[model samples]
Target: MIQFMLVDDESIIVDSLHRLLEGQEDLPLKVWKAYSADEALDLINIIEKTEGQGIDILMSDVMMPGMNGLDLSALIKSRFPELKTLFLSGYSDYTYLQTALHQEAFDYLLKPVDDETVIEAVRKLCLIIEEERRLKEQEKQNGMRLKQAQRMLNDELLRELLEKPLTPQQLADKEESYVQASLSVDQCFILLNGKVDQWPLTYTEIEKMRQREMIMELMVSMLQPQCSIVPYNGSRHLVWLLQVKRMDHDSETCDLPQLHWYLSEELERVQFTIQERMGLSCSFVISGHEVDWLQIGDVNRKMGELLDRAIGLKSEIMQVEQAGEAMSRYQDIQLQPQEIKKQLLALTGLLEAGEFLAFMNELRSFFETIRKSVFLTYERQSEIFITLAGLYLSYMNSRQMTTEVGMKLDLTYLTNFNKHTDWQSFGDYCVRLAEILFLIVGDDAKEQKQEIAEKVDNYIIQNLSRNLTLQQLADHVHLSKFYLSRLYHSQRGYPIYQKIKEQKLNRAKELLLQDDIKIKDVAAELGFENVPYFTTFFRNSLGMSPKEYKQSYQS
Candidate 1:
């Protein structure tokens, strides 16, 4: 029901309208009265201050002391645009109607006012206010949706820029409204050209490209090196600009040869895994020492020539001037079929058997030949990769990384997963990586285990209503209940049961802050049969009960 105020100079008129409005059922108006325009002014001031919002409707008489109804309506309208106004005047005065029009009054009733007329005017006023409120709410929602869509589009545009070189105008246009520019210097050009189509990862090129960027980002961060990477040559080439403090050629800090070697080694490792796990074929170019962005065109041309030569000879990494040296270095390498058999056998051995290290050495030797081969056979690569991964996992299991350490290899959850193709080599690489990871982390297993625990902690959140339990999760990952319990305590330094209780209490605090759901319901949903138990738990953890938490949010 809409609340309304009745104002007139006559007590009789005010009394009559108040009785009439109070008695009404359809409009169900809650009417208050004032005897004169001066009195009405006092009442309006009090209500606006106390309520901190305008009254829905103001009904005033035209002739009331010094200030008339039209004047009052104008003052109220200026302060509250949404407020509706009505005037009462006698004798059907044109002057009164004109004054009301100037005031932008909602409507005017001729004296003496009828009960039906008042009810209808109030009804119309209420509908107008409701419609305005709904429109404002819809506008707010539309604004939020527009913001979300804009952010998504911005992310997609940035991704596209990374995959291919855009002209200055295209780059500027893509980031026109969203990005802030930053300064950079030093650059190199890399051209990826070869029979890439022959690789098993035909469909995962974009993903691989993203993965490459990620490796670059992390590597650059560690090096504290200033570098900017842009895609060039229709997504088949890369332009990199790296800046550093000037240093002697022999200093590791700015030694181009050393830096190139380090980056090349890491890329080679990733490439090998991509082949073993994803069954993808790719070729890359590394700009020669002293090359800078100023030489991009020249480097690109030379890189293309090298790529063509490598494709002709069947190789993945080609140096335009150092082909003879690379071939000589790798020529004597051969497939270690015996080492391959040994690694497969070690997958069944225990951690204490020392077979894992031997297996790694064997793989390194065996891959020497395959690594240099231009015609990388996916089938052959996949078999070796799968066997190596199985062996790695065996070592991880023997060392109890999964059980005592609570470290599970979550390859799919990694952000890098979206950047690569689902190639056989990549798949094999992931499996083998997981295996060797469990073994390699053995050196600092405690620290690594703690990090993995933190990641899992973030995943749990404070949704106590969820069915998150150790036994359930253990079954999902094919681990025993005992192992899961021990690992949770060892790695996270907390009992599983305690973690669940803490999560539930946190959620209860969030619900209490909302002031919508009742405290009892929040308690019930967090697995508490009694509301008192939830209050006690919350009080214990936060030093205040749920009621106190709700008050803090309100205050």
Candidate 2:
């Protein structure tokens, strides 16, 4: 409804206008009368005090004593912006309209106003005000919905990208601000093999997990300017990814083993001090292979097997078997291969016998020996095979791979494992994987490294739309940290990560150019949450706003 307040010095003028306007109902206006400008000011103050409840229109005579109608209109405009005003004066001069415009008055109502002009002005003012209000309301609603959606997407993205465990609500509340950069970011994951057990599963265990995660997060934070860490798999398992780690700086000063020990100690402390706490026993398995996040199901399924077989040992040495050769050929010592094979064969037997404790112990020993052998580079391919086997065993132990997830892990024709320069490493990794599976294993550490690179690259490209990292990729393709890094850099010229970013950016550009789509839609399509950041990235890459760039192309 359009409401009005009428103020004039002459009571007769106010009375006449009130009576005439009272008869009108088509123009949604409710009018009030005051004999003087002072009375109008008081009424306005009361309405303002009432929080804009009843009043919408102000019709006042110009040229009143003390506080003139122009001054009152200006005052009302400064405070009650939504109150539409009409200046009523006997004089028809440009001065009043100019002042009325300055105060943003709706229109000028000439003195001794005719009912027709008054009705028409009121009707027009009401229409304009309502339309403006509607637009503002719509804009507010849109902004709110955008914010909500952004929160949801960011939470999901960060959870996967960071490998951190966060609830949807917590993600919605977290502020995810980005660091502006022209250099593309390559996601990197570090998988550490550690078992944290407390005697009693209490809040203390949770706290211990939190502390360990925090320590790891802090260490990674030092490695990279931005990083995320989170608990995975029953809070005992942890996953970390690099957001923007300084490779050069970390390589120069980073002491990874020391950092690992620090986290281990924190884990131990919680176990010792807290009731029902068991100490944390951990093994370090780091990889920097690039793969997509969606493909993790496959990579993890394979890598989990690696982690499983890497722990626990019945033998002094863990050997990487070559394909098509007797396991005895790969044995370093007379009894080493036989003893390892015996233990491997016994694992399923023990599990079937319901020997959980012994199973865990054997598993732990296998990983310890595997870790020691994996870091050694007597034959680089052997190391790679051992690494792949360990990762596969880890997944097999975890048992997260379902038939649906298995579909993504299949080696296809696109996986060019034969072209790798580290053919020995590729062969070794494959043989080791076969060994982990208890398949017939021979050690032929004579595979090309380029073939390994090709297979890994193919997997990355196939799953580019997901959140993935080098660590996961390395584990999937079964290459050691050192071998994968050397091969990726040697083959790709730049890091394998640069290609991932270029691919994503290319897709983003194509989406931005599409028509009849909201900028928010573009961000969602590219798996970004904040549209503003998407806008910033688009502008930085294309040298103009997305909207402007699209329009330029259209023209």
Candidate 3:
């Protein structure tokens, strides 16, 4: 609502002007009137204190007895530079008031002016104020969008750092991404993976984000070190990169055993805190030794593997054994961890896209690589099986198809890797699972398209009188507007918006048949901007005006 203040020496002018603007429904005004400049200034302060708002527009007499309109305008302009100003004056006073009114002020109304002239000037000022407000709101929204985009970019880069080595150019450029992520390349650091245990499949994306953020904050507060957290997308895991050497003291670099013991002690505390405070348990795995940044991709992937296979316990803190010690036997056969995860992620993407042939081919190649390893052992096979099974189970849960898929296919491999004594046995099971997944995906696509089409048709029919856009329909179906448009066109054999116009035409015809319904009301009910647009539409479509259509229908 615009706060309008009118000031003049004459009581009648102030009272009449106040009433005229106060009753304008379109303007949505709250009017204030003052008999003198001093009173207006006082009221401005009082209203500001009481309402927490300043006058939006100030209309004052040009020639007053005491401090004239010129002095008040100058004060108002200096104090509230954003407030719009308009002047009221006679021909004789115009010359006197000329110097006081800035030429750029909102246009003035002359003395002996009609109420319409005063309102018209004020109306123009209101439009300017409203437009300014709109632009400011737009700027705010744009700023928020920019912040969210930057955050998304940071997340993507963080994922890259965990999954692959930086290119030579990135190192030469001295990329700020690692710095922004608080990972120091010149120093030793530890990577920790935490998996929030037993996250319900129904927990939405937004809920998982909230929980991850909360857990991140809890860990940061307890650890009290330079650290950064990156939560895995579409999964219940969060990774933390923490500096190994605390810089608070000269002799504070953590020795290997001390660092391992420190991490074990601290992470258990963190886990206990989670169970007690948040009623959740997160299983964790931290690197056994301090590692360099260049090996982060491999270290992170190996840590995740250690956490993936827990046969007997849940929410336990496990550490990767140092590579030269317990890991020596498997080191020769260990595939590049980053490459393994990359192909695994691609496998999930292929499944999502319903590329059954590609999925099977990728699955075959992945298992074959594991089988071909001369040093491949039962333990290594168990880890590979667990990771692959986790991926399939996660996909099924995300689609809420776990129960349905389980009923048709044996999912025992997901938990019991020991049953599949050889890679070939497990590979065959995966192929069977892929066959079912493909069938469901194809059928699901057809079902989804039909459901979306029905929803759009029903919405258009029901909300004929309401303004509707492609975005609204897309939002209802939780799809992008462009994708929804393409889907609708594909499924219904017409553009979605074309259906809206057609439905409006059909609804208009139905409404016109009722004699008591006015033509303009029919236009309004059909969501037309005005009667003429409706008339034009009716005549163009049916070769008759809405009135003509009504008359002919009555006959």
Give the winner by lDDT.
Answer: 3
**Candidate maximizing TM-score:** 3
Model 1 C-alpha RMSD to native: 26.8
lDDT of 2: 0.50
For model 3, the superposed segments whose C-alpha errors exceed 4 Å read 1-151, 167-169, 200-206, 225-236, 245-258, 322-555
RMSD of each: 26.8, 31.6, 21.3
Q: Model 1: per-residue lDDT, tens digit, 1-555?
A: 455878888765577678767776666456768877677668878877876656678888888888877777777677777567788764334467667766667776655344666777777677566645654686596684564455455544434543444565663454444232121232233322222423332223434454444334333344334222222222333333334334443433544555566556655654565455335455566666555433545555556544433422422565546655754654454345575566456544533354443433444444443444433233444465556545444655666554432333343323232222323344434434434354345444555445545645654564355546554444443333334444556675665567776777767777787757999999888766467656776876789978888988899
How big is the positional error of residue 417 in model 1, measured in Å on the Cα after superposition?
67
Candidate 3 per-residue lDDT over residues 208-324, each given as its tens digit: 565676687578667755333333432325787666554564555666456667777888889989888556767777785667667778888776555443221246666666423
Which sequence of candidate numbers ranks them by TM-score, best first?
3, 1, 2
lDDT by residue for model 2 (339-445), tens: 55565666556544444335445654554444343222223324434444454445445654323223333332113432222222233333333322221111122
Please give the distance, in angstroms, between residue 427's alpha carbon in candidate 3 and its true position after superposition. Answer: 19
TM-score of each: 0.26, 0.26, 0.33
lDDT of each: 0.54, 0.50, 0.69
